[model samples]
Target: MNRALFQKIIFAWFEKHGRVLPWRVKNHEDAQRMSGVRETLATYFTKAWRRDPYRVIVSELMLQQTQVDRVLPKFEHFIKRWPTVLDLSRAKLSEVMIEWQGLGYNRRARFLHEMAKRVVEKYNGVFPQTETELRTLPGIGEYTARAVLAFAYGQDIGVIDTNIKRIFARVELGVEANAIPISPKEFQSFIDFSVPKHHGDPWNQALMDFGALVCTAKSPKCDHCPAKTLCIAQRIAEEYRVKTYAEFLKTPHRNQQKKQSIPFEQTNRYFRGRIVDKLRESPIHMEELRMHMETNHGLSSRKKFGEIIESLVLDKLIYIRGSRASLD
Candidate 1:
């Protein structure tokens, strides 16, 4: 696709049907009554929350493989607790982990903690601005580093995540709606060239929202979709598949007959049980903690349990007073 044509299609789609999110303040009615939607989106895209690298990094990290709804509360609480990289650096590692309890993938909490320390110690409590510098930090990868630079620093570097990947795969690769391909660096280049001038941040975010709500992983509502005319997947569905959208809508999801979800057991889960077990036992020395693990408990090894205890200690769930360990 040509750059100007791509921009016209995407921007047209975004202007007419872009989902309004709470974070998008430019569209707020109080801001301006007569602003064009495209201009409002562009203003929101450029001027919105591009100052703090830590905020950008934290939000991105919290969002990793997690849905926006699940991440919102956790992200808010984290920012409230830490406020800044400096605050997070001064905080106990245990405190950070405790705050991170419900987020799952506990390793991210550890990485954030270490990243905070590194920032404070090495970077004078300020997050690195460039993508290269940010990438050198613990837990910061290419995607995350680029996200920080683009979202926080207002850099024009291209960012392509899962949502953008799905859109690009369908549009460029002529893939089926259900069979989106993985994103390649070539796709990044395509986006860099095709992205609306001076609208990289909001444009990327809009693409994400578009994929999530309209061009969904399952059962996309192509008729309502902004990119319907230009979409390869929709064209394929029309040409190759005999079923109309109305008829397709009548079909139940393939796994609809399966259980809606796996049972979420609070008590039987390993960590919850371990916390209970630790509380029941009398205060034990670190050495005694190791011995108990080896003798009575069928735990993998004392070393492993010790590491858990250490994490628990850092998280402030457990603490050692003198040589004995107990719940905090």
Candidate 2:
């Protein structure tokens, strides 16, 4: 593959069509024009916008397994509420959980709170710059660590999230569906090779935008894709004019197969959310909580409900005082 040509095409497309996100910093001319402030792009960009590690960390954590549209308002609200690591570290975890109501995976909010506390106490409230230091924080993994380094610090490191991985699998490896797993080592090498040396941040962000908008997993816009000519999977799909790689690969029988039934209310996640939601309002006695769940949500087993409460207490998500339960 001609790497230079590939980079040129992708970057050109991104310049014209990249999404105008709130977290993204505006160009120098635009920033100055809007704010009536005479500052260099680098100064405004680093000190005021995208280079703020706290904003990047909050945005990244909220975005895990969540969509961009859903994250935008929440991210703005969160940052407005806690503008710095020191502010977040000083806030109560229960208040944090209350703010994190709509965004599920409540555990993430707890981890984020813990991460803030640690950063304040251990690192003097400044977010870490290196991948190793970042990974030491709560709930940060390999992908998230690299993302922080690249996006916030402008490090020339590769970031391969699910979307980028899918793009590489289809465009480079000729894989039809992103569901087909690629070796981690192979994927890392592709990211390393594809990421440009100088424009590492924009390069990674462009690939991410391209994957989300054009090269989506369910229904790819193959005809409109910039890399369609060079994409092996797209070339193969053209024979059938396939819109979705998964649909193209599905057998008729499998397509018609019935999905298994799982009751939402009965699941642990649902009950846990309910418990948190109720506690968000006010503290309730243990017996009163069980009765409310049984009456409203058809929760029949007291033993099962007790187990769930115990788990929540163990997770430090809630506290039990005498006979009452409330968010910690």
Candidate 3:
């Protein structure tokens, strides 16, 4: 359960049964030829293949309020479209929203676009190298900034996402297997002392993947867990496997809860569609577009339509045309 034993177990298990992901590998032709990978996934198990700072920033932004699997396709689509920070900075806000479709919680798209603008204007379209500088960007939180600094730029700092938080919480605190309450300060402490000095990036990845695959939320495979003995939850399991804090707590269920479904033919949908349709055609005056949305789309109020329009604007699916509106 000591640090040395914990590190030994986890590192050994990592060498044996680690998952292979595309982003983990270096794909450059020279790197590939030297690394003996099939031109696509050299260094597939290490941190020598993380994306650049800009891509890391984009991926982190997209990942907020969204799952990794869901973010992957959208990430690919976004990379194809923008390809670079300057490209994104110049892209129409509305077009970015359209590209961001299906990622729900549309506000993130707004932050991303704004962040890109700031990057272009201030950082000369290059991501900041230090965590402090990176965190100064729009919508870049501490965790995200640290992640970019560590994973992308290879800075030696601890980065804690949900997965790493869970692993450390259980391993250190004897909390429930899947229900650990993680705090930023405590997680930072773990990161400061847990990860090996030279291999901070891979060690972080190992923790993330270990939490995801071995120490999963619902049911953990403790028998094969690398840090099992170090894990407080496993110690609890050793004494009483199926009994923990989360198990005994009981709560009421508000069953049969349902949303008052908005009708498809409602003005909201119509106005939204019309806004998109018009934007597609060309930019229009904001006042004139508002009138169309209110009258033709049966909108209840200008304010309501305006809010929707604003949301669309933030999503970057539409553009403002000479103080008016346009589709991107």
Candidate RMSDs in order = 19.1, 18.5, 19.7
Best by TM-score: 2
C-alpha lDDT score of every prediction, in listed order: 0.64, 0.74, 0.67
Q: How far off is residue 95 in model 3, in Å?
A: 1.0
TM per candidate comes to: 0.63, 0.66, 0.65
> Which of the two candidates, 2 or 3, achieves a greater TM-score against the reference?
2
After TM-score superposition, the amount by which residue 141's alpha carbon in candidate 1 deviates from its true location, in angstroms, is: 0.7
The residue pairs that clash in candidate 1, if any, are 94-314, 94-315
- Over 1-328, each residue of candidate 3 has an lDDT whose tens digit, in order, gives 3777877777677666666543443322333344544422224444363556767777778877888789878886787678678889999999999999999877888888988999999989778887788778888888888888777766666787877777776777655424333334434654556767666667777777787788777666776665655777566544543443233122111011112223455634456677898777777888878777667777767677766676566556787767688766
Candidate order by decreasing lDDT: 2, 3, 1
- Candidate 1 C-alpha lDDT tens digits along 70-143: 87778767876776788899999899899987788888888999999999999998788887898889999999
lDDT of 3 at 254: 9
Candidate 1 yields a Cα-based lDDT of 0.64
The segments of candidate 2 whose C-alpha lies over 4 angstroms from its true place after superposition are 26-50, 177-182, 238-328
In terms of lDDT, model 3 sits at: 0.67
lDDT of 2 by residue, 1-328 (tens): 5678888988878777777664554332343354544333233324423356777778788899788989988986887688778899999999999999888899999999999999999999888888889999998998888888878777776788877888887786556333333345435654666778766677788888888888887777775777877876655555556653444545342232212223566665678778888999999998989998889877888877886686577557899999999986
